[model samples]
Every structure is written in C-alpha cells, then in structure tokens.
Target chain A: MTNSQRTPYDGIVMAAPVTIPYVRYSIESAQWWIGRALGALVAQAGIKASDIDGLCVSSFTMGTDSGIGLTQHFGLCVRWLDTIPLGGASAIAGLRKAARAVQARDADIVACVAGDTNHVDSFRLTLENFSRFNQDAVYPYGAGGANASFALIARNYMRTFGVSREDVGRIAVAQRANALRNPHALMKTPLTLEQYLAARPISDPIHLFDCVMPCAGAEAFLVMREETAASLGLPAARLLSTIERHNAFADDPMQVRGGWAMDVGELYAMAAVNPDDLDIVQTYDDYPVITMMQFEDLGFCRKGEGAEFVRAHDLTIDGDFPHNTSGGQLSVGQAGAAGAYLGLVEGLRQVLGAAGPTQVRNARLGLASGFGMINYDRGLASGAAIFAGPSR
Target chain B: MLQRCEACGAFAYPAREACPSCLSPDLAFADAPRGGVLLAETTARVPSDVYFRERVPWRIGLVKMDCGPTIVAHLHTDCVEGAPVRMSLQLDKSGQAVTFARPEGETPNMADDRQWREMTADPKFRRVLVTNGRSVIGQEAVVALKAAGAKTVFVGVAEPWRPFAGEDLLRRQEGVEVVTLDAADEKSAADLAADIGGKVEILVNTTEYVRAGGLLDRKGTSIARDEIDQAYLGFINLAQAFGPAMRMRGADGINNSVAWVNILSVYALANWPAFGAYSASQAACLSLSHCLRAELRPGGIKVMNLFTGPVDTEWFQTVPPPKVAPRAVAQAIVSGLKNGLEEMYVGDVAEEIRQRLAANPKALERELDR
Candidate 1:
C-alpha cells in the first residue's frame, strides 16, 4: 500500500512523557513501577486519574496481570485498553494504538505506559521462557539469551559491511556522553573510546559496554485530541506519521536490516519529510548495532553505509546530528518492555522542548524507531514514529 | 526429523503447525539435506539457564540450511562463520532434539568438541555399572563400555556363588571389577550402592527374566511375578540406590555422571501374545524411565532407552530367526550413548517394529499378537 492511501493522524497529539527513573535492581514488582508511571502521567497532565478512559500497558514481568488487571489495581474504568508485550517495539506500537483510539472518539484520553522490574534474576528467568521458538530452537543450544543472538547479528553485519569495532564504539561512546547529561540515565560515569574497545566480552564481539544493563523502570505518555490537550493547557507534540511491522523479512538468513526497511519509504512520505528534515532522531539502542541498523533502514543513510554515516556525523546531543538524546536504552538501562518506548519517549520530549539537559537545539521535528523480540534467531518486531512540535 | 510443506515445498523446524510460506497444514516429514552454511557464531560465556551455566563458553551458530530454513544450532569448534557446514540432530541433556553444525568435511577430534561431548554420554574416562553380569547381554555390555573408554567397569554378578558359563570371561576384562548383587534382593542393591554409587557415572540396567507364556496360558502367577520383580521392581531398587548419587554429580567436572541406560525390548510398545507378561513388565519399566528422565533433566543427566528385538538367547530360541545378537545389542547401546539418542531401536526387527508402530499401532499390535 502507498502512503497516500492512509488517513493522516491529524487531531491526535502525544503529551506528558513520563519516565519513572531506572534502578539497577528493584525489590518492587512490575505493577509498582507501572503505577508510578500512570500516577506521574495523571499529575503531569493535570487531570484526574479517572479522566483517562483508555489505557495501553506493556510489560514483561507482569505475571498473571495485563492492561485489564492494571485498571482494577489502580482503580479506574476504561473504554479502550490493551496490553502490548512487544519488547522493544511496545512504545511506538502502543502509541499508534492509543492514537487511533483517540481519533475514533472511543476514549478522550489514553495513557500509554510500559514498565518492568529487574529483580536480579528476572532477566534470566524471562529469557528461559521468552517464546516457544526461542525455548525450542534457540535457548537449548547455549541458553545464551539475547546476548548470543545479537552477537551473531553484530558479527555478520561487521563482516558484510566492513564495519570495525571502532565504528560500533563511536555509537556507544556518544550515547554514554549523552547519558551523562540525562539525569535519569542509570550510567553516571563518563566512558572513553578506549574503555569501550577494551571492555570485557560477554559473548565474542559483544562487549560489556555494547550491551544494555537490565534494570527496573517505567515510561508513560498520554495520547489525546489536540483540542483536548490545548484545553488542558498541557505541552504536547503532534504525531506526523507512525508505522509498525512484525516478523517482516522472515526469510533473511542474516538480519542486518529490520522491518523498517520494508515500509520506510511510506513512513517518510506520510510525514512529508526528508532525512535532513529530522532535527532529532532517537533509535532504539539495545545494542549499538541496532542503532546502526536503524540509521541505514530509516533513510538517515544508505544500506551498508551506517558505518560511514556515524563516522562522518557527530551524534552527541549538541553536535550536528543529535540522536538518542536521552541516552537510549544502552545508557538509560533496558527496563524490559520499557526499553521499547525509550526512543519514542525521548523523541516526544525533544519535539515538545521538555528534554532538560539532553535536549537538542531547535528540535522541532523528531523521529523514533524501535526493533525488538529475538524470538529465535533474530528480532521480529520493528516500528517507527515521527513527531513534530505543536506549533509546527 | 524434518518437515516439508506439501503446498509450498518449504522446510520448517521445531515442527511448525502449518506451512511457513503458504499457510497450508499439509506437511510431510522427510530427511533433510545436511548441507548448510554457517551464517554466524558465538561463544556464550554467560548462560541464561543453569544447565548450560555449568558448561560455560558453549559454542553456538546460526545456519542457513540449504533446504530453506534458518536454524540455531550447537556449533563445533571447527565450524567457521560464512563457511559451508553440515547439520546433525542430537538430543541435548533434556532428551529433546537440537540441531548441531559441523565442518563440511570431517575434522580431527570432532567428537571431542565440547558441544558434542556435552550431548553424548560417551563412556570415555567415566565409571560404569552393569547389573547382573551373569546374562550374556549384561557381560557384553560391560565389555562394550570398556572398549568405549570407560575408566572402570563394575560388573554386578548377581548370585555370585551360582556358576555361569561367562563368569570367568567378565572377571578377566582389564577394567572390569566384579561386585556381588542380586537384582531380586533390595539389600544387595543398597549394599552395592553404599560401596560404589558415589563414583558410578553410567548405569546400564540389563536384568531380564523371560518366560514364554501369555497370562491365560499360565495357571499360576509365580512366573509373572518373577518377571515383574526383575524388570519392574528391580529397576526401582537400582534407581533408588544409585539415582541420587548420579543426579547430584551431574555438573561435577569433565567426567560427571551422564546417563542411565535402560535395556528394554521392542515388545514394550505392543505386547506379543507369546510373551505377554514379559512385554507388560517391559512396558512398566519404560514408563518409569520417562518419569526418571523428567526428574534427572534439571541435572542434565540423560536416560537412554535401548530397545532391541527378540534376542537370540535361550529364552527367545523358539521365536524366529533374525533375532538380534546379545553382543550386537551391546554395541548398539554404546553407539546410542555416543550419539546422545534417547530412544534407539537396534537390529532389523526392532527398527521394523518401531516404524510399523509409528505408522499404524493397531496393525502392529494385531501382527505382534500372533
């Protein structure tokens, strides 16, 4: 389908991006962090908890509970509700679902939230039963979880494109530098290029710094009619376009490219922008290789030119190209499904002039992309969203 | 086993419900082409599960099978990225099928690869226990295990005072150690366990009491009772005595406890009227082995069942020709352990019965009855 056939996301606006601060480990459950994010959203939007008639919840550690159970746990009623378990793709995917609900008048306000608690052993437990394909086909081999899966992808990508460890290090080093400016990012120390290169390997070619630190946290944003947001006097960002795809290119032996490449032409066409038009871009950074894939697939660079693109452009928040302005998941810490929304939340804040220390200058237009779910050999979900300042 | 979609001609792994391409439910199991290319590989230093954690630094690979599917396989150290490779399906410690990748051509010490070593319970350098070495099959099993590199073969000669033709043959084997234990006596098993249970790595149960009579053909239940005591009850005594020690030492260094071998009969799948009581006892032992498999799975210990057709021993002399030899059955057991196969059908008749049972159980049941 062409981009012209799709209806524009005209009146819906995303506002009140709330991050519940990542902790290396938490004694609390997923509900505790999700509840905090929801409460934070209500207080930040200056609306009563009951005003949100819709909810979109995403989490990996929510045992025997979903979006429906969450409403009762938090004491509210909703006309529209959903629970997205799409790991790193949950944020953009959840936002798109909430925006459509608002446009259809099914709910006046929809709260899109994702959260998970890392209880020291939760990451390992989650990987054990992540999916049927993963358990039967992938885990039995080495039980290496995502680390081993991504290592293969990184190694293949490096060999095919002649990308070096230094190229990958550049993305990580810049993200760590951006993390230093992000108050809520879990990594507080500065990182050197030498440190990233010299970091110990968890799986060959995937060093300690190349991987994200699993943590406990939550992120939430509200999707409502632009008029409703204006009436509430809440700062907001307008949705230009959003696209999501699952299990695309299942036949690719090597997953160096993601689903974004399948419909990227339409994503940019509907948003009516070129690659240069994006003042800020936030690509999911579960690993530095993913960011490089997003750069190639999202039209920031040609296929196999991700190395050249990162080499030529400065990715720091104050540099020529400001990417992952909130330090992304690699620096902020991957909080289960909350990691999926990391890039989208940062993109929304940037366009709304709300990103405090890591805000890009004159960030009027922004793009966020997500890739996730290594169900077996490779990741299976991809999504992206373009957001613009309310004035734009 | 590999599945090929009838509609789209595509191959799928992990047994898909429908064709991955055309969404057709019509799928056929076929032998897969072994050819494949190693797309990528890694050495996992940190494992998500405890079973692999003990065997850290496991080699893993992603391969694009020549047949059409991409598979995640255990990698041999010789398997290089972007190089041609071949695949084999080996049962992991869980007794579930896991594909493995190796070099296209044979490599030196391929069997010594860590992934291969972990999956296969090769008797190499590990201690073993063979029960009731008085039986021809039992004595042969002790010999086979020793030839496969077992450091010590503890042959349990039940009723030690009773003279057997092959008793001297078993006692003279280089690595063979004679121990007195009666399969029917619970105390004997316990006494043996107290002596060597802590060190026995592989336990091969080869006790059998064969009587050629159906239930209705026998007036008294004494013959049936003896069969149950040897095949069914004797299994419990051995499992209880040695199982705990073996399970506890699953992750104990390189020569850790690995497998429990159950020598059973093909008749266990479907009873033969000629030996109904014996078949029933075999069936009961098979069921218990499944339970033991689950219990020992967490420790990564394998429970391998070697099912053979009618043996050429005196008990099966009246049955028919093509009966598997006791020495040959012993060789099959060692081979199954080396290949990490959970269920192995040895000999022509055993393999034929296995195939017929899979294709049509009711037909095989009727045919075996006669």
Candidate 2:
C-alpha cells in the first residue's frame, strides 16, 4: 500500500472558541452544559442561532444523546450532523470530520461542541463500567480506573528511557505554574517541584498533582471556510494540517510512542513547517507522564530525550517553551470529552491572539494534539491539528 | 484458558468471538502457555470501587504473554517489571474468570501475599466455627482447622449433654472448644451465633444425615425428613444466624471473617438411586449456596462449596470400596480453605462425576443409577 497525497485544509478555518466555565460539580445534566456552550459559541461568533447548519457533538454524560439527539433538543436542522466518540481525542477528531464536511460544502458552518457534567459519583460510575474489555479484564483486578494503568505505563517508560520521578515532576509543577495565571483553572495555588515530588501517590509514579480533577463544563468552536468567516468579519485561525490515528504501534510491548510517532513526519510535511517553527504546543495531558510521551512523540524532542527537554526548558506561559499555556487539563479540570477540546480551543486562542492572561507572546503558530480511550492497556486514539494566525 | 487464532496463530485474551490479529473466525479455546513478563505494576492506594477500596493497596499489573495480548492481572507483591510470572485463571467470588500473576520464583511468606489472601481463605490465626462434631468428617475438620493455625475452633455439638464418641478428646484439644448447638433447632443455632458470631472467621457446615434406600424402598417420609432437616433446613438455620456478622467483619484486619464452607456430595449433580433422599438434600443445599454467595459478596465474604464422594462411615457400610475417608475430606477442606477455592471435588468418584457431568450432563444423569 502506498501513501496518497493528503488533501489540503485550504480555506477552512476555526473561530469563536467558547469555554463554558467549568465547575467542580454540577447539579445540571450534560444537556444544560452543552446548551450553554452552544449558546455561548453563537453569541461569541455574533451569529444567529440558526447559522450553525452542521453539528458535531462529543460528550460522556449526555446518556443516549449524541449529535442527532442534540439537533432536536436545540432545534438544529443541518445537512451534516455527526458525533465523535473518541473521548480525550473527541475535539481533534471532530475537527478533522467537520473540516472535511465544510471543505466538501456539506454545510456552510459546522459547530463542534464537547461537554460533560460531573456529579460527585459520576466519575467513579463511568470508570466502574467504562467498557466491555475494561470491565471484564482491567476493572476486576484493582478497579483503580485509569490511574493504575498509567502508573504502569509511566513506570515502564521511565525505566525504559532512564527517566526519573523528578523529571516527571517537572511537567506537573510547570503546568501548575501556568495554571496560576489562568483564573479559571481548577488548581489556583502556586505549585513547586518540591510539592510535586512530595505529593502522595495516587498510583505509584503518578502523584496527586499528576492526575486531573474531574469537573463539569463544555468547550466549542466553529469550523467554516475562510469566505464564510470573511462575510461575517470574524477573526479566525487558519487550519494548517491535521493527522489522526487509532491503535497505532500495536506491536510495541509497551506504549513508548503513540501514533503521533508514525505520522508526525507527515504532519510537519503537510503543514510545510518544521518542529521549531511552532510558537506554542498543547498536548493532551491527563497525566504528566503522558505529556512527556507526547513531547517526545510529537517531534518536540527525540524519543529518549523528553526528560532532558523538560529540564532544559521551562514550560510555563512566560517561559521558553510555553506549552499548555492555558494550563491544560492538569490544572484546568478534565471535563470529560471537553478535556480533549481544552488543548485545541486553547491553541486556537493563542494562534488568534485571543488568549487573555495565559496568552503566549506574539503567538503565530501552534499545535494541539490528543490521545485518549484506554479500552484496555493503553490509549487508542491519537490526533493533532496545526493552527496558524490566518496565514498572516 | 486463552483463545488461539487458527489463521494467524496469534493468541487473544478475554474470550473474543473473532481473532484480534487476523480477524479470523477460526479460534480455539484451550490452555495456553502461562509464561509472561510483568510490564508494569501499581498497588492502587486509592481503589475505584468499594470492593477494592476496602482492600486498599490492591496491586494490579500489565502482563504481555508469551502468546499475545497484554492483560491486566492481579499481581503478587513480588511481581516486578521485567521478571517472569506464571499466570492462572481463577474464579472470583462472583463466579467469573479473572487472571492472576504469580512470581516464577518462590517468594517469602507466599501465603501472606495480598494476592493470595484475596484469592484464599487461609485459616491462619483466624477463628473458625464447625456446625457439627458428631460425624467422623466433622471431628477430622476440627483437627485440620487446628493444624492450619486457627486461633480458635468452635465445635457445635448438638445436645452436648448426650456425649459423642470423641467428646472427651475434642474438648481436651488446645484451641478447640465444644459448644452446645443443634442445627435442626433454630434457637440452638441462634444461641450459638449470638455467642461467637462476631468472631467466626470461617464456618464449616458438616451436618449430613444419611440412610441407604431409594424412594420406592422407603415406606414413609421418616428417613427423608431427617435427611432434609440435617442437610437443607439445618444449613438455612446456620446461614441466617452467622451470615450478617461475618459480612460486617469481612474487611476487618487479618482476623476478618472470610469464608463459609459447605460439605456436599457429588451426587447432587445427578441423583443416586441408592441414596435418593441424601442426594435430594445435597442438591437443595447446593442451589441455596449460590444465592448465599450473591448475598454475601457485597460484604466480600465467600461461600465455598466442597463436593465429596461417598465417605467411609457406618452409614456407607453397604457400599463398596473407593470411598472417600473422613480424614481425606478434612484434608481437602483445609487445603481448599487455604486456596480460597469456591468448589472442590474430593476423592476419585467425585472428580470423575464432575468431569462426566461437564462433558454430558444428561448422559451422566442416566449413568448415575447404574
């Protein structure tokens, strides 16, 4: 099989990034959160409610509701409607599908929305019956949810690559520092490297700060052709390139690299950019170890050099790297599928110079990557999309 | 047992319908090579569910097998990354198959390992309650429990004022106390439970009333009635009395109440004409144990059923050789308790019946009478 030339995103652009203010726990259902987010997206775009002709919804707590269900609930009638079930990769994956929809003229504008409501016990309930493979094989062992599995992955990756707990602690500490600047981040207090190392382990190798807090919220954005955005005079971020993969590197005994490693070369090739050209990067960071893996796999550093890369550079917004500049999910609470969208939305804000306090200086180019859905041992979905400032 | 794909020759776990590798529909479920290396492990200090949360510091790991498919398994404390581990499929309290990893090399205090403790009901320093002491099987159970390091073994002697043959020796044995109780009488069971219910870590019910006769040979329901009282009704009395207390203490320290044992006959699977009344009673108790398991599972208590062949006792004088001895039953009970096995078939006849029943239930039922 030969690789075919990829289609360019061309005139497609993303605009009107909306975050529906996360809360620790919400008495309201996922419907309320999604409705609020969709409402906010329309208001921010300064468009009529019916302007969003196509819809793509992503959520975990909406029960039986998907994109189709939301259409009736929100009175949406559109040509193209779908849902992304990729969990932490939901928004990035939704971006790929919606971008193609708009490029192919399926709809004039597509609203990509991800939301989830976190009740006190909903997180545990979701984990208890996460999936068939998980419930049958993983949950029965210790029922530690994702924490236990990632601990193993983290421990193995550290040993395999000669990384240390201190190196892993650096990721969490820096993210917490970045979180302090973002007023909406769940973790408000300043964090130090010492506190990260001293934090009691949730699962060994994964400390308290390494894990994301579960919260209720929604994130949304609009995908449209440049002509459509120009007519409305909306400030939008141009889509440079994107890549998506599932269950990649199936033969590796341990998940040292994700699908990003396999397709990262093409990602940069399609974007017509080098790794050094990016001004900002946002990696799906449910855990600090995963962030390290992403940094190495996404071409920020060599495979075994992620530890040294973190040590050599600071990761806070004002620092040299400025990765996860909007605090990521490590500081901002994980809002189910919205956790996947956090990076994409934050990346859009940075590229468009729309980020307030957490904005990167003179941000022109950025990348948002996602990894999610641990059906059994490791996460299956991997995706990334480069966002640039409307091609200058 | 793991499934092997015939087309791709790759191994798949968790009983899949089609091959994960080749998408081959041709698959065989058989015992695969148990060799595997521990990839990573975590002793989840914070568990997700109440069942595991109560038993905190629960260790689990990722194990990629010599065959294929990485599995999440209950890991022994000694299971370290890059070290070899042997895997086994054990039935949990819910009667579902779960993988467990054991160290290839012997580890110190192996029985004390959390993984072993989770899977077994080892009678080490835990209090035990035996519901009957009149039969040879009952007497030997007391002796075995004491040898297995039971802190206290309470022997329930019905109508203790009327002494049994081994009454003097049982009372004289260290850590063994004879208590007054009658399985047939509800008050007797309740009284005994009220005294020692909170402390009984393991309960062994060995009350069996047997007589030689088919349903047609029996004139009245007199003999059948006695068998039902001792086997079926008596079991109900003990379970009702002691179940709640054991459940409440299921997650208490090492001395926590663990398992309830039932001595059953393999003939319960298929009735034996010669001992029709006895077989019927055994079947009834076996059915009830399944219900008791579900009820006790929420509290993490286990209801283990021990199936045995015809025992060599006065009641089986007319039967032929190849009978299970009382001592053998006692030994099986102790070992099964240590293993925390839900079902144990003792003696050649019991094992034979179990296999035959699995292969062909209807055929075994027809052959049992012959």
| RMSD of candidate 1 to true structure, Å | 2.4
Of the true interface contacts, what fraction does each candidate have?
Answer: 0.88, 0.90
lDDT of 1 by residue, A204-235 (tens): 78999999999999999999999999999999
Which candidate tops TM-score? 2
In lDDT terms, how accurate is model 1?
A: 0.90
**For model 2, how does the per-residue alpha-carbon lDDT over B1-370 read when each residue is reduced to its tens digit?**
7888889888897667899888999999877999899888887888878777778888888898988878888988888888999998876655567898999988888778866776778898899999899889999999999998899999889887886798888989999989987999999999989999898999999987888777887899988888888889998999999999998888788677889999999988889888887899899999999998988887777888989889999999988979999999999999988877888999999999999999999998888777
Where does candidate 2 chain A have its weakest 10-residue lDDT segment? A1-10
Q: Give the per-residue lDDT digits (tens) of candidate 1, residues B222-301.
A: 98889988889899999999899999998888888999999998888889889888989999999999999898887778
Instruction: Write one digit per residue (lDDT tens) for candidate 2, span A108-166.
Output: 89999999999999999889878888888888887889999788888899999999999
Residue-level error in angstroms, candidate 1, position A192: 0.6
Clashes of each: 1, 0
